[model samples]
Target chain A: MLPMFSGKLCQCLSVTRFPSILFLGVIYVAYVLVGGLIFWKLEGCSCITNKYSLLAITVLKMIKAASLSGLSPDSNDTADGFWKFTSSSVFAATVVTTIGYGNIIPLTTAGQIFCVLFALFGIPLNVVILNRVGKYMLAIERNFSLKMMWWVLTFLYFVVPMLLFKEYEGWSYAEAIYYCFITLSTIGFGDYVADHNPAINYPEWYSCLMAAWIFFGLAWLALLINHSIDLLESVNAYMRRRKNAQTQV
Target chain B: MLPMFSGKLCQCLSVTRFPSILFLGVIYVAYVLVGGLIFWKLEGCSCITNKYSLLAITVLKMIKAASLSGLSPDSNDTADGFWKFTSSSVFAATVVTTIGYGNIIPLTTAGQIFCVLFALFGIPLNVVILNRVGKYMLAIERNFSLKMMWWVLTFLYFVVPMLLFKEYEGWSYAEAIYYCFITLSTIGFGDYVADHNPAINYPEWYSCLMAAWIFFGLAWLALLINHSIDLLESVNAYMRRRKNAQTQV
Candidate 1:
């Protein structure tokens, strides 16, 4: 009797322990471990690039100070104007879109204040507009007679852009795909920004095209997220129903 | 008769043209222009830092290559491990949270692929959990007797953490507020990441505390977004109702 009681107790403990915060914490740690292992293997063991970059920035600052003090001619050739209309639009879009790539952040105090206010207003406007547009797209996608064609178009959307990025930016296919995912996810890491190379002198249409792609793609992404959640909920309900039937039996 | 017909035509053109894509496009362009003008005024008409940074990176690469080829002793003193358990978890959280800082991105092809897959699953999971938690918090907020106190607590939430960041990171109050808005908005420009200074020997809990703050703050942000949208929608509804009543009168 004591052995049976102990066995039941063990079963209860096993079931209860595996579904709560402790279990989630363990899984989270494991996920992080796996990520670390892979990143370490691939990227080589390293630390934050902040130290090296900080060193470089300090040197640059000293050089700037020297130039201002008439030690050397300012290298106008190496420095391009960052606030060109096209690039500024991209920057503004990044703020409104909440993509904040950090590649071209405002350095001055006033600019930073403006950035905050711009975001405060722009983020909601973008969200509301996108929400409206997304619903329209979803309705179209649902009602389209040729659903397969629509899916193919969606597939082509990503594939075609991958080629453009590969050709223009010299990124490999994997990197292009990675960029697409990262951007669409709104992660905007700014690590692999397109059209950032000044020497290439990309066409005016290039950045505009990429910006439009992201603008529309974000709405599509939100739609997909909603659909995915709906799918998961349905599957969950089905599983619950099956369990209920088993219990009844 | 001709003048009145022309006047009606002009009225029709004005009303129709100002309500569609053209109007929105004009507003968007104006917004971008204002942003550009402000940034230029504050930041001193400049181009991207890409050129200088590329030069710096190239030099760093040469240094690394020389070290690898045994021309110079490696400067291991300046480097630290990027894949510490805590940092790895922070990286994982960033991916799942869709706030990719790009400061410590995966350099390997395999690692990048893993990152993509991890995000695919992790984002949805995080969203689901946060959605559930947000609802609970909203319920609590609604039912609490001291709504004013709760609001004050929310105010203090941002204020207290701003102090902590100011002390530890040496950011001014304005810079700290900017970071808070940028991060909570999920713009995550990454230009101002906390705890990035390797020289500062931060407490073990520092990063973890910041991470927790972001995670919780994200849910609160969602709630705020929802509330703002609801408020806008109700105002819209009220405006429409008044318009309809006026027409009837």
Candidate 2:
């Protein structure tokens, strides 16, 4: 019984050559750990800020002082222009686009309600706008090979935007690239925001340009993700057919 | 020339029919404005906690004190548990899931890079999981009419979760239902968070349940959204055919 079980396991292992998924998982684990260590060093090193400060200071001390006294450094930024005309415009753009970066939020009850209402119209309007833009892009991209289309999109969507973001935000190339990926994927982790700080002097038309950029960039990403799904579905269907054919044979 | 112009205008209006989109836009504006008023009354009326204090205190004065004194209420919460195990896990779930409320954030640079890496694997894994779940739902829902599918989904995704959340967070039924809509739509404004403050003494299994809720809830939403697209596409195809037939006649 043991021999038969072992034989079946070996056969299964042989059928699935080169454990790529397992290998990727290991690599991913290592990558995230290293990232955590780096973040711990950069942001979480001190009790004045980072969460790991509890390691040095007792938990009781942290809770007592932090829960009261309003001494946390992060406090000042949360409500910074939480409501203002220009920021409100950006807020509307972000929410409707479904980026919801949570950088500048509606802390007031009114703001939260407005957010919902804004989303109802804004989401549908944005969807219609994005679809229109997508149809145009698709028409232009027609007859292009998938590889060529990808390269063109990468050039237009990723490269140009990364350069612009780096220039406007004074972010490092890595940070700008990271921001592009986060925003385009709509994962929108609000850590690295562009045109957020009013103290930073940007172009007068900066907001307008940025909004247009987001609109077009998101449309491109939607197209790419949708196209990728089609490819995956076809591949899946082909695999299923082959399996059925093999079984019948 | 005037008669010809009038004839063209009439033709355009008839083809467009009720101008439903514009009517919807006006209705949407009214809905959001009403929402804003309600929220203002509920949470924005006071400044001790709400960000709308500037409406009373003068922006210049608040900015001076806030910019200098490091006394932003939001600061304390941003890093409340920015790096603790449960918070980090919650952060991971939020980030990959793209529900980033920004209620908590990694202030350090290292945390940002780690976020990028986590998202790389996590997003794809989530997409695959959601797709599989969507497939199962689509298979099961094949025989059901659109209205019936929508009703079942609302009951499962919205009503059930709303009840669970209200029980867990002690939020009002309205707030719970609002949360269900916001979260499932992935709007994630961060004003109303569940299970954040450990002092609240929620059920021991609360976190586990919340995670499961998010996973399943997101799958249901994915199915609903996909089903909607199919309905819209079929309607669009039918409309186009009818137009073509009318033109031929």
Candidate 3:
């Protein structure tokens, strides 16, 4: 009985950790493929080396990246037998996270009321989510200090790409990183949005390919952050338990 | 020595909490008076109904009510200096909290990178902030056992004025709440923004007055949520410690 209980506990933990990670992975790949295709079609026959083409490629990259890092709400087990597709919790999560993506906005009076209510609910929900994430982060720091790991990983993931983009894509290192951050954060201020390169006429397929790359890149960045947070919290929690046990003895 | 130490601690606590609270209080009062005066100058024409005047009066009243009852942020220092005012921490808190009032956005490439870094920093900062807030909320819940306090407070602060505006000012309840939420959240979708009511004749002064109200009202809501979270977390932590100590014996 004890073995079965422990096994169930381990299974539950693994399930929570891995399912979302895997799901996000699948979604991101799909997003990259689709977004890339669309951008290729849209920007093809345009100047690939021109400023407009460069901008188009950058924008497409952002879209693919964002789609990959998308978040979904945890499903609750309620015996009520009625499926609530849009629970208040989930709605709150989406809006507060700024995943606005413009997919949903309140159109009616009730809808608007619900929107406000959702935000109201979301403010705390965000807090709760962050708390859990924090716990995991502390765990990681205990095992392997996050500062050191973060610096190393950031160098590989962000700094390297930034330099490459500057050299090959004609962006300044600062500009590339800037674009990367803005898109990943989903601010999408649109002030410095990418435009198609006007100089080089590329095929439609190539244009789409560039677009897919941009979106997928952003999505991956978001995913990396989420995963890191989870890992950190898990490590922190384990350390805390160990310390507590030692203290009690 | 013990007495002196306790006294000093109390003093420190008061210094942290009282000043901010007083500052916010003063701001709230000034906002109401200035807002009311502006409305009076701009829209208090002879053609307007007494109800319109009353509605304006109640708007001020609701603002006050909301300020006092809503989740208020710690006017006091509940955490160490390491967590407070760290640029990265502040940026994270500001973004994740959706206080995106547009007072600031990434202006330069460096700034954008900073923004993303902040978002990364923010995920952890959010955890700390939420845990702190949750403790306070738990305390309140224990004392009152009123699970609906937040809901009730939200209704009074948000829903009531919205409903009143709909009935007296000829807005649909949905529209009023939508206006309230969008303005409060600072999402400012700008899709359904409020213009001058017929009574106000869309005057410049009225427009300015409305803008001021929107800004302050949004600040008030944000502060309220921050406060509530802190309160809940403090309470929760205290309880958890107590439980642990009891178990140790």
Candidate 4:
């Protein structure tokens, strides 16, 4: 029975000549861990913020001093404008890419109007730019092997970013990968956003880095999608031809 | 000055023979308003909820009754499962469509894993379905007038939904339009979600209606995109040919 089982396993192994998928998967995981470590060093470490405790203490003092029921928190006072330079640029990038995390959406009427106008023109402009860049990428891709292209996409564009986000955003592995997948798929679920934690003071360049990553990553994704559509169309045409021949016969 | 201005306007109008863009713009506005009114009638009116005041009263009573220094509100108790049938269906639709509103996400590891796997297969399936349906839409479109196609797509799909969401969600006109545009564009910022107000009781069929709208609306948007891309490519080819001819000359 043992000999027969060993024989069956050997046959299964022989049937699949190369374990390319498994090998790629391992490399992808390793790339994320190592890239995360590198980014952790570069982005610097974070210290705990005492703001919450301070606010709690202040609030308690205020409550104790004013014993009357006339004290109500003004909700309007809590609403702060998030239209800083880095945030605005990130918002703009999200709009053009169709990610639209909407974590910091435009609130005022004029701002909303601007957002619509920007999207009206920006979406097409983004598509044009991506197509032009994709042409150049396609030219470059043709010179490289298919495995090499996959490695580049998997390692640098995808895996590395996953770990980098994990390190910077302090999310678990699953959450990090989830965020990356969601964003790249253009499913910008704004649930787990990078640099959203008020306690952690991220570097000035972080948002820029994230924006650049999204731009290049999306271009690569577009190339992959285009290739996929082409493959599907050719297959479809071949199947139609077969069907037509069968009918004629 | 008036005569010269009128003459200049006449020349501009002549240069652009058909005011198609302007004519379409008026129809689009009218469609949204009429659609909004129709949907408002169908979805029913809303009343204000007293839950907030009730909660405030309870909290105040609690504080007065108990020497609350030893008591703290459990944040965990406030967290309830949002994964009801209707919500789950909406969430699934969002994932497949790559809309990912992130208003309600998978909190468990098992759910998150399932989400990733679902998205992996679902996005491709969605693309394939859209392509097949788009082929039929193309056939129908070719048989009909272009203006007719625009009216159908604009009035039935885009304009109608804008109002429906406004009526149900109680958003302003601008907000409704913004939500529709954001969603159809697939940005899906999710700043304004339908049936999000806990105060108002939404009908069971509301979410199903929304899911259907998104699926069919996306198909129309996809067709529009394909047409635009085809036009752009042809224009690109013409420009390339002109450049080649100029170079040869």
Question: How well is each residue in B75-109 modelled by candidate 2, as lDDT tens digits?
Answer: 33423323344555566667666776665554344
Q: Weakest 10 consecutive residues, lDDT, candidate 3 chain A? A: A74-83
Q: Report the lDDT tens digits of candidate 3 across residue range B49-132.
A: 222222333443443444443432231222221122232222233354433322223334434554555456554433433343
| TM-score per candidate, chains pooled | 0.69, 0.61, 0.39, 0.66
lDDT tens digits, residue span B137-217, model 4: 665555555578878877877678778877777877788777777887788877667777776788889866876677677
How much does each candidate deviate from the true structure in C-alpha RMSD? 21.6, 20.5, 19.5, 15.7
Count residue pairs with overlapping backbones in model 2: 10
Model 1 clash pairs are A46-B82, A80-B47, A81-B46, A81-B47, A82-B46, A82-B47
Candidate 3 docking DockQ: 0.11
Which sections of candidate 2 miss by over 4 Å? A1-86, A107-114, A117-125, A142-149, A231-249, B1-86, B104-114, B117-121, B142-149, B227-249
Report, for all candidates in order, the number of backbone clashes: 6, 10, 66, 0
Considering just the first chain, candidate 4 attains a TM-score of: 0.67
After superposing candidate 1 on the true structure, give the runs of residues whose Cα lies further than 4 Å from its correct spot.
A1-57, A61-80, A146-150, A234-249, B1-57, B61-80, B145-150, B236-249
Error of 2 at B47 (Å): 31
What's the TM-score of chain B for every model shown?
A: 0.66, 0.62, 0.34, 0.66
Q: State which docking tier applies to candidate 1.
A: incorrect
Tell me how far candidate 4 lies from the true structure as C-alpha RMSD in angstroms.
15.7
Q: In candidate 1, what are the lDDT values of residues B1-249, reduced to their tens digit?
A: 556545544543454333432433354334334433332332221222122343455555554453443333233321224443344455666776777666656555655666777667566655655564465566455444336746664675588778988999889988988888888888988877888776678888987788668877887877777777677556655765676688699
Models ranked on lDDT: 1, 4, 2, 3
**Model 2 C-alpha lDDT per residue in residues A112-223, reported as the tens digit of each score:** 4545655554455455446646765665555444368778888877788788887878887778877887787677766668887657888888777776677788888777
Q: Which pairs clash in the backbone of model 2? A: A39-B110, A39-B111, A43-B108, A74-B75, A75-B72, A75-B75, A76-B72, A109-B39, A110-B39, A110-B40
